[model samples]
Structures are given as structure tokens and as C-alpha cells.
Target: MAHHWYRNTTSGNSLQESLDELTQSQQITPQLALQALLQFDKAVNSLLAQRVRNRVNFRQSYGSLTTYRIGDNVWTFVPNDVEFSKVTALIKVDKVKIAACDDENTGSNAKE
Candidate 1:
């Protein structure tokens, strides 16, 4: 439950909008709404970790590693002449950015 990437995006916006409505109607206090949203974030993180089964692997061949970065335990790579494959399908691109995160390092179980 460490990363709430969707909290500021589409999925989280709906909950925030609903909370705003409830707050304006006086059915829930602002503090309560905030707590609810925070709980929603945690719930979403756990649910995705536990329920999502889809996975994709990419294999790339590049002339040289253009750039690489590691921050917050996530690795980002920008390579030139990249090719990505999932199963038997292959895609080629001039330049691509790849970002990877290890769930174990983040204290989450992505395969559970």
C-alpha cells in the first residue's frame, strides 16, 4: 500500500468527487471524508496487489543504454533501438523508456 499512483488520477477522482458531495450535504465532516479517502487508497493498493493477475514481460535489444536511473527503489531505463515482446508478438521503437518496480522492495506482494 505504499504507492497510490491513482490517487490523483481518474480512479481516485471519483471517490474524491463523491466525498465532496457528501461534505457539502453535511452528511460527513471534512475530516471524516479525508479519512475515508485515505482508507480507499490503502484498500485499492491491497486489492490490486491481491487480485490482479495480468503480467507482461518485455525483452529489449538496444545499441547502447542511453540513460538509466534508480530512485525510490524504482528503476527507469531509456534505451535506443528498443524491441519489446510479449509472447510471440514483437514491437520495435526508436527510443523507449522502461520503468520497473519490485513489489518485495516496496513491502508488497504483487503475486499473492
Candidate 2:
């Protein structure tokens, strides 16, 4: 089974909660709710792939990497005392987490 990464995000979680409520209220069947969530995943992934065009790159400096992990082609980094620099802004923070996923294994079901 492919991992539906978006389902763990805030919006996805909200949708799932709403579906659960609908299922509990007998407004929708369990199977239909499941299908709806699956479609949500597909639609969101497809839209992001097609609509999002601009890419921003940033470098983190003056930071110490507190934690690093790699699993399922996903790279996670947690840094402390970091300064992130973009094109026009520089932001400093005490800590931040960054997650990166490889495109081929993003588990998106969108077919071009």
C-alpha cells in the first residue's frame, strides 16, 4: 500500500474528522467515507503538483542539527539555534524541523 502522506497534515486530519462524524451520524457509510478520504488524497496531490510552480530555496546557518532521520525515502532534520535565509528575508529561530520527500516516492496517485 502506498503511504498517503497528506492525510497526516492538518487539513487532511480535519477532513478525516469530518468524515468520521458523518459516518457516525449515519449520513454516510463507512465505505463511502473511506473512498472520500482516498479521493481527497488524490485530488490534493494532483492539485499541488499542477498548480504550485514557484520554488524557494533556503540555507540554514549558525545551527546545530539536533536530530536527523531517514526512513521510507523521507528525510527529516531538526535543528536548533538556526538562521534561515531566503531571497529577501532572514529569519532566526530557536528550533525548526524540515522534512523532504523524494518526488518519485511521494505516494501521490496523480497520473499525468
Candidate 3:
């Protein structure tokens, strides 16, 4: 969805600039200049295809899901009670720091 400018390698100027130069000098017709610009764009796009392929391979090798720590004041939805007028329980969880996990002591199924 992004537009890019194609430059002519001979003069190191954009296709638009080349067209303007030709028009000013009356060297080539406007229709021929337009055709040359289109051909230059096609050649540039063909060269860009290889670079895009490399980027796809790079993304596939390194892309991964990242985990983030949940904040203590995270919100949770609770259903409203039928009989109670105001029914909302906002539980505040306390953060606890624990040492390394042990199979028997920590009640974890981790193998030694």
C-alpha cells in the first residue's frame, strides 16, 4: 500500500525527474517518457523480489511469542447475584517471591 519512486541509474535521478528533464529539453515525446518510466518501475520491482524473499526467511527463523508478567491489580469479571443489589468482589492478590522449586517439597512433578 506504499508508493515508491523509481530512479534512473544513468543520471542518478528519479523517473519523474528524468521525464521533466526530457520535457524541458524536447528530446523525447511525453508518451515515450511515460513508457520508459513504467519499464523502469517493472525492473526495480523485479530486483526487490529477492530482498523480500530474504526478509520472509529471516522472520520465520527468529519470530517467537513473548510472555509478560501480569500486574497485581489485574481486573476479573464476576457475575452479578440475583438477590443482592450490589454484587462485586475485587480481590487484590499479593505478590510472593519463592526460591527454586523442589520435586517433593514444592509439590511439583518435576524430575530430578
Candidate 4:
């Protein structure tokens, strides 16, 4: 027989149902039941990590930002002009142009 990996369940009802059935049939002791619950938690966390990794990889390899032309409303963070100031404000303004910022040109001096 081949080993089959279970699909990630969002509702968690599948694991809960299995645990309930096991308890009803008196198949698992209290310690074993606790272990099974812990294992289920680990599996769910692993699935979440895998999903985040997949999204990051996809974006890095094949993601592009749409161009924003002038007059398009956007929110921007404005730094305080005064020296030694720590205040910042979010202001709404019309975009002048759209510029691409890839890994090579995303430093502090890069224009947005």
C-alpha cells in the first residue's frame, strides 16, 4: 500500500471528527489523544508555512506592478522636513508616474 498525505483542512472539522470517532470507540488513551491533537496542530502550521513560501516564490518569479498614471489618487508617507524629527504623516496625492522597483533598485535612494 502507498502512503497518502492528507490535504490541509481549513475548517479543522476533519481532524475533530476523527478525534471524536476515536474517543467514542475507546481506541486512544488520554495521552495518545493529546499527542494526536498536538500532531494535528503541527500539520496545520506546516501547511500554512508552505502556502506562504509558495506565494513569495510566485511573486518573486512572475509578479509585476500595474502602471499608475498622473491624477491617480494614492496614499504616501511624508517624512518630517525638520532635522532630527521623528514625525511622519500619510498624505493623499495624485501620482505623477509609475516606476518599477526591482531587487536591484529598491534601496533608500530609489524613487517610487
Candidate 5:
């Protein structure tokens, strides 16, 4: 499935929930739970960074940025921009999907 804006944060929340469950169940000490949650957060951030790299790389195959599924919206990401590292965290601003997909010089006139 394609990655969305809420995935990593949801994952972090789930991690904390699991830690709470473990601590309440007496399976782990509170101190250990805290350490585990911190470790999990670090790992998630690293994984998210790798995912961002993969998305940037995969974006090269498609010459035109006319692919998205949130109400049939389209997104265009600028490759090699340091700002793009935060792609997964930012809200979708490119929501215009034109009828024509064969041309790269099309206008983003459609709005959801």
C-alpha cells in the first residue's frame, strides 16, 4: 500500500499503547518500558527515513507527477530537495488531477 501522512505517527502511538499494555500486565518494569518505547521511536524514525528515500527513488520512474488516490488527486515531488525528506510528514497540497496525463506541461486546474 502507498504510504500516507498518518502512518508513522500512528505506528508510534501503537508502540506506546503496547508498552502501556506490557507495563500494566507486569510483564516489564516501567523503566524498561520507557527504554523500549524510546528505542522503538528511534527505529521508526530510521525506517521512515529509508521509506522516504525509496519513495524519492521510485518517483523517478514516472516522468509526470499525476498519481494519487485521495479523491483522485495528483502530487508532484521535487527530486533531490532536502525539503522532500519531510514528505511523509507534510499535508498534501497538490490535489489537482487533470484529465490529461500524457503531457508534462498540463495545468493543475482540478480541485477536490
Candidate 6:
């Protein structure tokens, strides 16, 4: 189980700037690992009967994780593998383009 900073309903494109700031300041990974179990899988059928719980409780000291989503909050899917984990992901959340600045203050002048 994993928690990603779901910035928007359609896509996570708009979260590039904030995510980068967070990644740098917090020194945390930008990628989030997601997992899904088949509803028909017999190995965990009993536990899957309830939708209330799917992941472990958020432990603040472990990782900066949350189950909340921003904006309209709708479910979407992306395909991948079953052998993934959050601890191993390294997503690049920063946008590739350089910003054209006018009176831009990047906190470079902040007093030390």
C-alpha cells in the first residue's frame, strides 16, 4: 500500500513545481508505488470484502504519506507490474522546461 500526492483529477502534471520543492526540502522520493489486488483472487478474498481498509495506517516518522486527493478526486488507472514497492520508486516530479522570469525571487536573497 502507498499514498501519492494526487494533485489533480485528470493528471499530475500541474504539481511539478510544488512537488519539486517538497522533494528537495524533505529529501524524499518523488515516485509513488501503487498496487491492486484482483477481486477474484482467492488468497485474500476475505480481507478484500471491505473497502474501508486497503493500506496500513499512516506513520508520520516513516514517510510523508497521506491518503487524500486534491480537486474533484476521481479514480483512474495505470498499468504496470505486481512486484513494485514505494521504497524503490524514484519519480521525476519536476517539469523539464526552464521558467522565463520577471521579478522572480527564488529565495536567493533571504538573510542567512
Clashing pairs in 6: none
TM-score of each: 0.61, 0.61, 0.37, 0.35, 0.37, 0.17
* Residue 87 displacement in candidate 3 (angstroms): 51
- lDDT for each residue of candidate 2 in 7-110, tens digit (9 for 90 to 100): 88999999999999999999999999989987897798788879977545445676688999877766788888877566687778898888766565345332
Clashes of each: 0, 0, 0, 0, 0, 0
lDDT tens readout by residue for model 4, 6-107: 324444667767777888799977678667766765675466447753211111122233343322222223322212212353333232232322222123
lDDT of each: 0.73, 0.75, 0.42, 0.42, 0.47, 0.30
Q: Which run of 10 residues does model 1 get worst, by summed lDDT?
A: 103-112
Q: List the residue pairs that clash in candidate 1.
A: none
Model 5 regions more than 4 Å off = 1-8, 54-112
Better model by lDDT: candidate 1 vs candidate 2: 2
lDDT of candidate 5 over 1-40, digit per residue (tens): 2223333577767877888899999999999988886676
Q: Where does candidate 3 stray beyond 4 Å?
A: 5-12, 56-112
Who is ahead in lDDT, 2 or 4?
2
Worst 10 residues of 3 by lDDT: 54-63
Question: Per-residue lDDT of 11-99 in model 6, one digit per residue for the tens?
Answer: 34334554566677875555521111222122233433354343322123323222332222222322222122245553332122111
Cα error, candidate 4, residue 99 (Å) = 33
Decide which is better by lDDT, 2 or 6.
2
| Ordered list by lDDT, greatest first | 2, 1, 5, 3, 4, 6
The candidate, 4 or 5, that scores higher on lDDT is: 5
lDDT of 3 at 104: 26
Question: What's the true lDDT of residue 94 in model 1?
Answer: 84
